[model samples]
Target: MSNKFFSVSVTNISVAILTTILISACAGNRIVNNDAPVEQLQDLNDYDSDGVIKAREKCDNTVLGASIDNYGCGNQITKMEPFKIKINFANDSFAIPDNAYDKIRVLADFLKENQEIKVVIEGHTSKVGKVNHNQTLSEQRAKAVVLVLIHDFKIPAERLDYIGYGFQRLEDERQTEEAHAANRRIMAELTHTEHLDEMEWTIYSVDQEL
Candidate 1:
């Protein structure tokens, strides 16, 4: 074998041409449209820009910046509110008073909006009266309020129930006018489930790399 030495000098322009050739060779099947290589790394199938790809995404059109799950659904949330309404009645009356109409209407509106809610209208009386008489009066008071809800506000019959607790669950045990007045009242306990989409917490942004 003969010893042969070859001297090769490459210019900057020649080196650049060789580099472009190597890059083109590396991208054998991939289309090169003068775009950056980073585009190839991004998930182009994700149309909504959510992390989940189109084939796997269960939810579509997910809001941008919403903290989405693996299924790509976001903005679905649940909420609960502690609601109570109190309306005091006269010494020996079960009438829905003029002044108490606004609060009752508000309660009705709440019920109208929240279809899943059920309301319990409770009635109580002072200890000065006989237990049996007070119980009957309490029953009347609660029933009166419930009727107003059903008739006036168009509240559904199935969503309402009345209960009497005459002198049993007194707000104050003292034998004073204020205590008696406070004890003689109608109360509504509200229960429901609330869900909101627009008012949800999030931890995502467009600034982040997809």
Candidate 2:
């Protein structure tokens, strides 16, 4: 074979091997994005001279693909403010149901795209159990969601925090399961007060070097 053909074959083999490794490493935590490539996510910053998707724009999600000016953040996009998305759990369990996946996916994607946002996922529980037990469960549920975000969604760990509010933050004291269920949820807080790019962390120098 010619050197060019031989080199192409070797390159293809190497790419395949590397892809396989990546897939295996992330298999257990991968989320299914029907539109995303099967192997990995395309960088959200793809753009053209005119700032359009290479082809006609089919999305309103981000601007990068088409006529987007700010990494697909739409014109109406606001900084990640203190927003709460509730994830309900079955009685006495912290297992996230299959139905809850999409919400988590959107959250993970949002956090990934906006680095200035730090989140505190507070888990809450109804008053059915002892206060301590409820607190522990609530914290565990929040951590569980964090783990899923890290392992499956590839969200960085440093950007997340988990806390159990127990029944302390309950919405109401009604005795019905429906009311209790309402109390069992995860609420997110945006810790940074400024826009991501404008937020700064400063380090002060001591008078003497340690």
Candidate 3:
């Protein structure tokens, strides 16, 4: 009767397992190409090149290379020069003042240069004449100025308007010669919205700059 025992070594088992692992690892090694979806950089492209990228650009077009703000939009501004034209007249006349050509020419040039503003030719009168007569005279006087703007200065007819104040808006209540002369006059006035160029690119300062 003999008792025989075979001792199993863990080192041999480890060696065999290591060999299997090496073979499996070698078999798993193969060239694999992954066709992944690459993101295109077109989103960052700016078509107008107005310093704002396409993703966040509000205004795409920059007019006349004008100045722009952060949102790729342009700043628009308009200014009316302290413009006024006064033409005095005789006691009962709508004729242009003798020394008013220079002012008229300047007015014409201004109207031509600035096509955005419309003007109203205002006529006033002294307190001496009848109310109805004064009103009619003032109306004629205003119309005369409007005609000058249209014919002489080439200002558009649509851009010029006429209104007469007569004795209603007398410059002076006194009947003095100087005061009467001041009252009997016509003047040009321009009124408009605060922002002249809303969507366009423009910058101006009335009486501030040329």
Scored by CA lDDT, what does every candidate get?
0.80, 0.75, 0.77
Q: Return whichever of 1 and 3 wins on lDDT.
A: 1
Candidate 2 wrong stretches, greater than 4 Å: 1-80, 195-210
Runs in model 3 with CA error above 4 Å?
Answer: 1-82, 193-210
TM-scores, one per candidate: 0.56, 0.54, 0.57
Steric clashes per prediction = 0, 7, 0
Better of 2 and 3 by TM-score: 3
Lowest lDDT sum, 10 consecutive residues, model 2, at 195-204
lDDT accuracy of residue 132 in candidate 2: 90
Ranked by lDDT, the better of candidates 1 and 2 is 1
Candidate 1 global CA lDDT score: 0.80
Candidate 3, 133-206: lDDT as tens digits? 99999999989878877887788898888899888987678879989988987777785544221333345544
Q: What is the lDDT for 35 in model 1?
A: 66
- lDDT for 65 (candidate 2): 26
Supply candidate 2's per-residue lDDT for 180.
Answer: 92
* Candidate that scores best on lDDT: 1
- The number of residue pairs in model 3 that clash at the backbone is 0
The list of candidate 1 runs beyond 4 A from truth reads 1-82, 195-210
